[model samples]
Target chain A: MTILLHQNLERAAQALPEQTAFVCGRDRLTWRQLDEQSTAFAVALQHAGVTPGDHVAICADLSLPAVIAIYGCLKAGAVYVPVDHSSSDQRLCALIEECDATVLVITALSLNTRHTLETHAPSLRLVVSGENQPEQRSRLEVVCFSGFLAASGRDPFVRPATTPRQPAYVIFTSGSTGRPKGIVHTHQSAGQYAELTATAYRLSSADMVAGVCPLHFDMSTFALFASVHAAARTVLIPAPVLRFPASFALQLEQHRVSVLYCVPYLLIQLLERGVLDQRLLDSLRWIVFAGETFPLRSLQDLRSRLCHVAFSNAYGPAETNVCCVRHFVPWQECAEPDRSEIPIGRPWGDGLCRVVDADDVVVEPGEAGELLVSSGTVMSHYLGHSADDQPTFCFCPATGRRFYRTGDVVRQNADGELVFVGRQDRQVKVRGHRVELDAVENAMTRFPGVLEASVSCVPADGSQQLHAVYTSVDRQALDAPLQRWLQSELPRWAVPSVIQRVPTFARTTSGKIDHRRQGQQMAAELTTHNKKES
Target chain B: MIDQSSFSRTEATRQILQFLHEELLNGSGPVTLQADTDLLASGTVDSLGVMRLVAFLEAAFAVTIAHEDVTMENFLNASAIAALICERQEGAL
Candidate 1:
């Protein structure tokens, strides 16, 4: 009754034997070819000392090689961890060490990355898959992805039957403090998440998903594997697209991609570029976006542009696969609902989300509380941190099942929709005033000329200052009205200490605000100011 | 609102100053900055300040100033940064 994620992928291959499973430019691989490559890569890795339960980290962008390697790692019975090739040299090294990665498969540009990584973690066996290597670098088995399989030319290998409880992948997410946390997930959790997503979005073997999120980011879990599990094809978008949005969408239109998973910020840029053209969206059947929600005007434009396709908002942290979804809510309601707030919506099949108070008591309808999720899709644990209770997986008496505390503040509306307030830690006391930014943003979201807003805290003049980052296309016109609106609605002390404008806010691969990056940016800015003043 | 004519006197420094402000300097200040702003020797920018400023010029102007370009003559003041930006522009063309 229970199936591992790889086994399900194998099943997808069996169902769509000759169908194209993945396509990258002129390079097309049928399901059969994909299965053969996966098996061969699995064997190649085994020969390289990768055993069951080992962590094999693929340090590369989203491409066919990375995708197959993920499959090979799972098929070989090891938990696969992915690092964005674009991750800084420092971060890449930190992740490899943090995950205690065994073997790394990388390309040439990441050669510097691989070198720096090995210098730190010398035990990590490196597999350089690229052009010929120097004589001295023999230990770095330099082989092309195809060459690796070609060398094993139809070599017979058996995939060990992995149980549902076995770990499938280890994904790293930002920590409030030092290094990122590596959250591990088992086959049951990963595959269950894939199934829930496929059912919610109505993805099938006929769908051609435009995979956008980086592999290191958790959003790509559903974008990549969900498509593969459904026997659907994934269009391997190039990595540089993150730096260029217009080009990314052109690739979408060129490929006639049917299913798209994106973040709201990128969607905002796409709208700014007037990318809501009907021609580009004609074949698109669904748009599933995650991270933080964007303005409603965007959803309305997107829906009208692709009037026929479904627009769904996906919600959940990396620690948990997408456990809840609110689909087909109109852009207007979703952007500015009747309650002037939107819920991550009802839990999808087999997923349970409830609002609970401080004492774990379930709140009544329209009451605000902590959101807890109980689902088969919850992560295994933060790898190597088995002793932490905050990360502890437990069963809730209210849900009568194991649930993960989402740490998000929300209130169930009269319509039974859950509207997000913010994170519990996000609440702050500013100058004897308790300011919940979510409340301010929720209020400002109703103000005209207010496209998107995020409130962050800082210490100013011996008191905490609430800073708001706002993004408006017509910044020139928005300046005066926005300042006036904030002055009227917010108390003297509650007003923003600094009102900063970004041409565009940094976004996580999930399209939510890249708060971690913003913090780094804010810190750097503060340091710059302190020096300037001194 | 930058007095473009006022910048003609310290073209090199002004360019570098703007580059630093957009890329290196993070906090808010005069939107229209000037050159000969006593950037480095005057203690306007420090070591990490230099690195941050270099990264900014590279991304904002799409220029690549070499490690050798990180010199007193190129990064000392607005004139220096403008010179650096100019050198990169010439090389790029």
Candidate 2:
């Protein structure tokens, strides 16, 4: 018997119907309400012509309705693609078109982008507003969410027969190419990840997990699926509260959140500005950080302050959801301020990993090379791309397993733990979000009058920031418009912070753009400028 | 005196709204922001935008905003920001 993601919800509903399942701001949903509402939503989607395996793109923030919509899509046997609600219209339209999404579960707050969606997403036939009733005037059929559910009647929805091998969801991430690549995960893969994570964290019904990451981010799967697997409560932190660390701490304390899975940058913010001394977050049992390396000094400070919590450094690309995790109790390990890197640890639960050279040959035990992951949690394939794509995956003949090529370069230490070295590509993590420099340059070149664009990563204030130098005919006139255009094209973290117009880019002997030289120059100039200002 | 303070707050609110619209938002945001709009809740301003807004207010109003004072209550909206600025100015005087 195969178990699907929504089956966890059903089991929990039967076992703990009155227990709170999800909480977002002032809204709360018990297991029974969540189950019934999601069932109603499933019926609504079916009535609205959403067939099994159809793509239903959810464009809403972390809210109760969005949670309901996710479960609803799963119950209806439709693939739920979570889109960043704050993304620009052009990006949203591109995703909707790429997935050929027939239905969109959107919040009222994002209705402003409807016009663009109507024009661009031709396959989008139905729009279900999560909030207020929209006055529909578009070619696409729009319905109020509440009304849609009410109209579906009380008839029990027949669960669609779905295999574990069927695609459960598609998450889009920054690609080396100009466009975003959608990573598709089957129900088996995602369900295996949820079970592994729940077992690793020792989650139970008494635990309250903090849903910190946005739905679009891959890390959000842990909070969303793992909690359901354990029948635990999930407190979806609102975006606004996240901006103020003090407020975020209040939310954690108020909810007595037991487990938090977020990026290191957010945890750093909580340490610096969260007023942790005032809040008694004694309920917090585990703090898992991933997506980027945590600065050792800050990690020490955070550990010192929150002495009771166990810290884990989780590592995996979006292709493989948390294949490796290093767990450490602060007091157990020696605090070495000089240590710069933390080990990403061994593969989790039957997962296989190996470091391979450029020729796909396995490297020596201590040698640094690109890491490959073969795990049940691994994504099936990137949407619209062949599974045999060399850059994405490599076949291990020795083990007869397909492994994801995690562009990350790592070395195995004496303890058989993987230590991060550097990237084998131009991909960099900016505030825990992946940004491909090539993609940023491509977006800049899309602007009118821009001839060429070169983006460089500059270390600023303990984190990496992107700086771009573009060649344009009209440098002075193109500044504001180019900035606006880039804002509309890329995610906020991917957009370059400092953009300068240059006559020409420095080139290497091979005629390619010299990014290393440009990055060094920009860093030097910024340092001098800061010094002069001070 | 009360009228003068209220007038100054209104003026400050206008200037802040203009700055948010032109600088932070870049006129591409989903909703048009009013003085009383919940900038945080509405997603009009993000974490980076909040930092930039604080810097802009410090320079524009000639008031220093302490790190501890950068709470949601003091920066929830244009009106709230103006009130924080006014209070800081009064304290300085």
Give the top-scoring candidate (TM-score).
2
TM-score of chain B of 2: 0.88
Candidate 2 structure quality by residue, lDDT tens digits, A1-534: 348999999999999999999998888999999999999999999988888989999888788988888999999999999988777788888899999999988887355577787888899998888666557676988887888888889877988999898888999984324788999988889999999999999999999999988888888898889999999999999677787888888899999999999886678668766888889998999999988655555676788888888999999988898899999775435544444457899999879998989888889999988899999899988989877787788888877799999988889998799987656677789999977786677667657566557788899989899999876543445777888888988899988999888755554321235677778889999999989999
- Per-prediction DockQ: 0.04, 0.42
Worst 10 residues of 2 chain A by lDDT: A503-512
| Model 1 TM-score (B-chain only) | 0.65
Candidate 1 clashes between residue pairs 3 or more apart in a chain or in different chains: A263-A511, A343-A418, B12-B79, B12-B82, B13-B78, B13-B79
**TM-score per model over all chains:** 0.80, 0.81
Question: Which lDDT value does model 1 have at A443?
Answer: 55
Candidate 2 — which residues are off by over 4 angstroms? A109-112, A332-338, A386-391, A427-534, B1-8, B26-32, B90-93
On residues A8-34, what C-alpha lDDT tens digit does candidate 1 reach at each position? 668877888899888876787888878
Query: By TM-score, how accurate is candidate 1?
Result: 0.80
Off by over 4 Å in 1: A109-111, A137-142, A329-339, A387-391, A397-400, A487-494, A506-511, A516-534, B1-93
What are the root-mean-square deviations of the candidates from the true structure over C-alphas? 8.7, 10.4
Interface Cα RMSD, each model:
15.2, 5.5
